[model samples]
Target chain A: MSQVIVVTSGKGGVGKTTTTANLGVGLSKLGKKVVLIDTDIGLRNLDVVLGLENRIVYDLVDVVTGVCTPKQAAIKDKRFDGLFLIPAAQTKDKDSVTIEQMQDLCEKLKEDYDFIIIDCPAGIEQGFKNAIAGADKALIVTTPEVSAVRDADRIIGLLEANEIEEHYLIINRIRPDMVRRGDMMNVDDIIDILNIDLIGIVPDDQDIIISTNKGEPAVVNPKSLAGQGYRNITERLNGNNVPLMDLEGNTFLGKLKKLFTKKQ
Target chain B: MLDLSRIFGRKNNSKDAAKDRLKLVLVHDRANVSPEFLQKIKDEIMQVLAKYMDVSDGGLDINLTTATGEDGKSRVPAITANIPIKSIKQK
Candidate 1:
């Protein structure tokens, strides 16, 4: 059975969709059959992020409502053969789908795929609850800003209250330069505040915006730092002890020394 | 006596300001008591205390401190109340 992972943030615009898209591609590149599902419903954007918008003939609502089969709604990615996307219904509201419906859909998908990643909507509302209902684990995405960190804390509290185990944190849009200058919160600072297991740290790269605009996730681009970070996260998910990426140049030498010492 | 110069330093002053803000907010959030509501509660608590002891007005301090559990997963916020006995003496 596939492990269903929900990528969510209580606040919007914290790179939840981007993280979902890239992680989907990253896992697929690792030879895992991955399916990315957008559960935002009315305000769907995962289709656009995955560059599968034009091909979304049927949506998650269609499959859940019995209007169409799951096979019909699942859009296979052209860039990666094993990766698939189940786009959210742009016309229907989140009320159209129930939590049980989502759980059933995911259970069915789990039979065929190795990883089922759900891109959840912002806020702790019905949409958020529905997205997480079927998830085996959760990834709380947050930026380094104070508000984002606070929101992530609240989301963690909610998850714990719901008795959901196996939730981790992904600090996205980290500006290493700002962190070095004490202008932005670092990984340690965020982890201290949220108090969750760190799964990944993606740097703030301009290439992300460009790639996102082009309907391609930054993870596929080898030269993008963000892409490398996502790939490292993917390896870590597969139980590989991949060393965290050095964002600031100051840590490069230390990391190199550690690598050499490990070899010895 | 505390070192006046070091106590008044910019870094120390800024740190104090941040700590005060965080403490106030946390106390309010954990107690579900707003500033106005806290003032009222303080007044009522003082009135109740005054029945047995003479208490000074606006002399009570309350703060929220975190208590960590053995499992590291359980963290509870507890209210720490400080009421000076000297202040409670009859004036």
Candidate 2:
């Protein structure tokens, strides 16, 4: 089934873009045809994160404005045979594209791809409405910080209000060490407050900076903890009951515990 | 070894504190209630209570919080007000 998923967080700089890039690439790596849409508009950066900045000839605006087709704007990622990205325009803002245009774009792309992941812009504005218009599911991303969780709560409410019922939470940048020391919010603590289902728990790893620096996602690196987390998320998204990552020490016992604590 | 947590006023885990604060803030956000609206509600409660009892306004604290349902898994918006009553009139 072709699924349109929107990656969003009400607050900015909370790993929405990173999760979108890594999840899209991870699904492609797993042999699923995937396409990512950078809906951040004027402040677009998904292309740079995917290392396709120098190849964007046409953009989302051009496709929506009839200047070009979705095929022309869709940049084919060389790393994956079935992966593509529709880069957002750097000069035009969010208002340039309406919600109807975005829906039409997703409906058109759904004919060719298995997954269409839309990278939503921060805040609850026109950009957010446009991003969620065509989405069948939503992935709410947040870090362990209070500000991010608060914004995430608001986003959840908005998603419910918008009638997007199939939503899941992705807690990104979770620090197991800080969580163990009682200095950061753990997965249970966050789920208790947000009252949402879990899908992904990405740890804070240095590999993220290294990958972004190289314009590549961390999911390609098997040794990277963040990469493992993203890969697990891809499996879970595919309806597989994979065990969660043992974030404590990444040991054999942690893996055993993960088997018993598999979340839906 | 000496314990400095009590001196620093951290008797509970910081993550617990963070979770508690996050929940409290979300209650306000989810209710879409501002401090000014809360003050208005408090003032109205005081006006109605003044006819029957002497309610201490300075020490009164009114907040928007969550109320769990019978299942305890479901939650809804609830107004929690703690008012210190000084006297009551015979009615």
Candidate 3:
């Protein structure tokens, strides 16, 4: 069965596009046909992040306006097979597409793709509503910051009000060192507030920047800690029981020292 | 041993402060009610209760909380009011 999931963050610059791009590539790498829909309208970055900016012949506005079909607007990934992107138009504003049109587009794409991941724009505006119109589930992405978490909480309430119950959480850009020093919120602290099922926790890594710049998603790069987290998320989405990575686990010597200190 | 540092310490770290602030803000945000309005509601409730009974000035509290219902699914927002009454009026 096909699943239409909307990846959203009410606060901007919380890695919504990066999460969408990486998740699309990660699922496609696992042999699933995935199509990513960028609904950010004017400020389009999913195409740039996926490194498919040069091949965009048509955009979502073209499809919504009936100027072209979804298949024609979708650009196939250069690296991962079965991965495609329907980029948003840079010229048009968010009001260009309505919720009904987005739902219709997703309904048509659901037949061809195994997963339709819609990258929603920031804020609870018409753009956000349009992106989530046809989604069966939602993945709320939030950074470990007060502003992001606050917006995430509001997004969760809005999703619930809209009757989107099959929603989950993904706490992105977690700084374990800062968390250890009580300088940043930990995973448990976020879960305690959001009170949603966690699909993944991506650690803060510089590798994401390099990969995004190269137009390659970090999920395909085995060396990236963030990539591993995304891969684990893909596995969980596929119904596999993969334990979350120990992003903040102490070293063996550190654990032994703690044990000795306790004994003393 | 009474640790002097514990008695006069920098009370909260930034992370804990963030969590505390989020907790308070989300309760109000989720309930679609402001803290000041909650306090107003608490005051009204106490006044209504005091009409038939002697209500205490303190210990009257109202809060928006999240608790799981009987369905075992997820947390639902709840309004809890606790008022301390001294005595009931004799009719």
Candidate 4:
């Protein structure tokens, strides 16, 4: 059965959707049959992020409401063969689909896909509840800001209360320069606060904005630092001990030295 | 002569500033007690303590401290109240 994972954040606009889209593509690139589901409902944007908006005909609501089959709702990405998207309905509210319905849908999807990625909406409301209902694991995305970390902490508390302890942290939009300058929270600061397994750390990159606008995930662009970070996360997900990409130029020389030592 | 201006110079320490802001907000959030509410509580607690013994009226310290778990699973934030007794000096 496919591992159902929910990408969520308690606060809004912390790159949950972006991370979901890119990670879906990243995992698929690793030859894993991946399905990305948008559980946002009414305010769907994961389709736009994945550039599958124009292809979405029958949405998640359609599949849950029995108006359409799950196969009909699933939109295959042309760029990646094994990747698919189940977009959210733009008209229906989050209350239209219950948690049980979401669980049922995910259970059915698991038969075919290797990974089922749910793009959760902001806040701990019905949408959030529905997204995580069938999730075997969860990735909490948050920025380094105090407000974001505080909300993430609250979300972690809620997840633990719900007995969903298989969750990890992905610190997005990290500015290493600011961290070095003592202007922003570093990885250690975030790890100290959240106290979760660090799955990924994506640096703040203009390439993310550019690729997002162009309907391409940054992970596809090998030169992009954020892309490299997402790729490293994919490797980690596959049980590889891939060292994190050094965006701050801190580990470049060390890595080169290590390569020379291996050659020797 | 001491350089008093140097001693009292403006320091734009953003890290310290951010830490102060976060500490204040976290104390309020973890306790679910606003600064105004805390002021009231502080007064009431001081009054209640004063009934039993003499407390240093305005010198009491009430703050929150956070500690990490051994396995780093979660943070443990606790509220601490320190009230010093005003000793009556022998005349």
Candidate 5:
């Protein structure tokens, strides 16, 4: 069965696009057909993340406006099989696509793909509504910051209000060193505050910067910790029971030392 | 009022400060609490406090805030009202 998941974080610059790109790559690596739709119109970046910027002949606006079909607008991933991206328009307004069009587009694509991952824009605006119109589930992305977590809580409420109840959390950009030093919010604190099921915990790895700049997702790099985290997320999202790979334990000072001592 | 710095002392750890703060923030956020909601709460509190003693209406200060318990591990959202007692009333 196909799953339409909307990846959203109400606050901007919290790795929504990055998560969308990598999860698209990660799911496809598991041999599932995946299509990523970028709904952040006029500020499109998914194409650049997937290294398909130069190949976009038609965008999501074109597809939804009936100017082009979904097939013609989707750009296949250069590195992975069964992975495609439908990028947003760079010149159009965020309100260009109606909710009905977005839902219809997802429904049409669901038949041909195993997963339709929609990258939701920042804030609880019409863009967010458009992205989540046909979503079956939601993956809320948040960093270990007060602003991000607060927004995640609000987004969860919005998701529930929209009747998309099967929502999960993905805590991104965690710093184990800071967490061990008692300076950063750990995974448990965020999960406890948000009160949601965590699908993955991505560490703050420098490799993400390197991979992102190269237009290659961190999931493509086996040595990248972020890659492993995304893979674990894909596994758990696929219904595999995987123990969380967070660097800290339930207690602050005890288990965190053991986990990081081995790494250092 | 939530004494944020004390809860974030080295022994308490700074991360807990964030968690506790977020807990209170979400409670207010999720409840859809507004200035008007707090005013309504304060108004009801005033009616109850008036029965026991005379309270200085001008000095009344009420708002929704957080307080860390004695354990310091569990922080909860609370409604605080600072009503100055003007005089005692007896039956």
Candidate 6:
């Protein structure tokens, strides 16, 4: 069955595009046909993140307006087969694409692809509404901060009000050292506040910035801690019982435990 | 040797403070009530009550509170107004 999932965070700069791009690549790495739609419209960047910025012959607005087909607008990724991206229109504003048009596009995409991931724009505005229009589930990405958590709470209320039942949380940029020092909100604190099921927890790693800058999905980068988190999320999405990655950096005790276990 | 700051410091850390503030603010935000709105309601309520009784303005405490319902699971928003009445006006 095809699934349309909207990745959104009410606050900007909380890694919605990063999560969407990585998940798209991650899902396709599992051999699932996935198409990622950038619904940010004027503030489009998913194409850039995927390193396919130069190959945009058609965009989401073109597909919605019947200027081009969704298939024609979808850019196949060279790094992975079955992974495609529908770039948002840079010239047009968010108001150009209505919620119904987005829903229709998602409905059409659902027929061919195994997964249709919508990268929602930040804020509870028209763009956000359009992104979640046809999504069966939602993945809210947030950082471990009070402001981000608060915005995520508001978004959760909005999502519930919209009757989107299947939604999960993705806590991004978790700093274990800061969390251990009681200087940041831990995963448990966020879960207690948001009261939602956590799908993934991406650790704050420098590798993420490098990968994003290179326009490569971090999930494909084997050495990335955030990439491993995304892989676990993809597994969970596919109904596999994958364990969450420990954001805690390896302590002496943890290292000793691993060493003893490996010896056995 | 142990890190002294890790052991003795961080009693009133900013992280806990931030979490507390967010918890309080989100209660009002989720209930769709702002601080100004609550203050307005309190002022209007005090004004209405003062007309009927000798209500003191100093000891009045009107705020939005959260309490669990009969299910005892969900935290529900409740308004608690504590107005001090000096005497009842006889008309």
Winning model by lDDT:
2
lDDT of 3 by residue, A1-264 (tens): 999999998999999999999999999989999999999999999998999999999999999889998889899986789999999999989999998998899999999999999999999999999988999999999999999999999999889988899999999999877875668988988998889899999999999999988988899899999999999999888789899878645555334433444331
Residue lDDT tens for model 2, A117-144: 9999999999999999999999999999
List the DockQ of the predictions in order: 0.14, 0.41, 0.36, 0.18, 0.39, 0.33
Question: Which sections of candidate 5 miss by over 4 Å?
Answer: A246-264, B1-9, B47-52, B65-78
Q: Residue pairs in steric clash, candidate 2?
A: none
User: Runs in model 2 with CA error above 4 Å?
Assistant: A249-264, B1-11, B73-75
The sequence of per-residue lDDT tens digits that candidate 4 reaches over residues A74-153 is 99999998999999999988899999999999999999999999999999999999999999898999998888988888
lDDT of each: 0.81, 0.90, 0.88, 0.84, 0.88, 0.89
Give the distance in Å from residue B82's predicted Cα in candidate 5 to where it truly belongs.
Answer: 3.6
Which DockQ value does candidate 2 get? 0.41
lDDT of 2 by residue, B64-90 (tens): 888897898777789889999999988
lDDT of 4: 0.84
Candidate order (lDDT): 2, 6, 5, 3, 4, 1
List runs of model 1 lying over 4 Å from the truth: A250-264, B1-44, B56-61, B65-76, B80-91
Query: Candidate 4 — which residues are off by over 4 angstroms?
Result: A250-264, B1-13, B19-24, B27-44, B54-61, B67-75, B82-91
Output the number of the DockQ-best candidate.
2
- In terms of lDDT, the poorest run of 10 residues in model 2 chain A is A253-262
**A1-264 in candidate 1: lDDT tens per residue?**
568999998999999999999999999999999999999989999988888889989998999999998888889998897999999999989899999999999899999999999999999999999999999899999998756776787788778877778999999998876664445667876675567899989999999999989998999899999998899889988779988887755576444544444331
Q: Residue-wise lDDT of candidate 6 within A1-264, one digit each (tens)?
A: 999999999999999999999999999999999999999999999998999999999999999999999989999998899999999999999998998998899999999999999999999999999999999999999998888999999999999999998899999999877876678988888897788999999999888889888999899989989999999999999889998896643776444434444331
Range of the 10 consecutive residues with the lowest summed lDDT in candidate 5 chain A = A255-264
Interface RMSD of each: 10.2, 8.0, 5.1, 11.2, 8.3, 6.3
Ranking by DockQ: 2, 5, 3, 6, 4, 1
DockQ-better candidate, 1 vs 4:
4
Per-residue lDDT tens digits for candidate 1, residues B1-91, read 3433233223433334433444344434544556686567667776778776765555678555666757986556665667765434445
Root-mean-square deviation of each candidate, in angstroms?
5.7, 4.4, 5.1, 6.4, 5.2, 4.4
**Residue A257 C-alpha lDDT in model 1:** 40
lDDT of 5 by residue, A67-105 (tens): 999999989886799999999999999889999999899
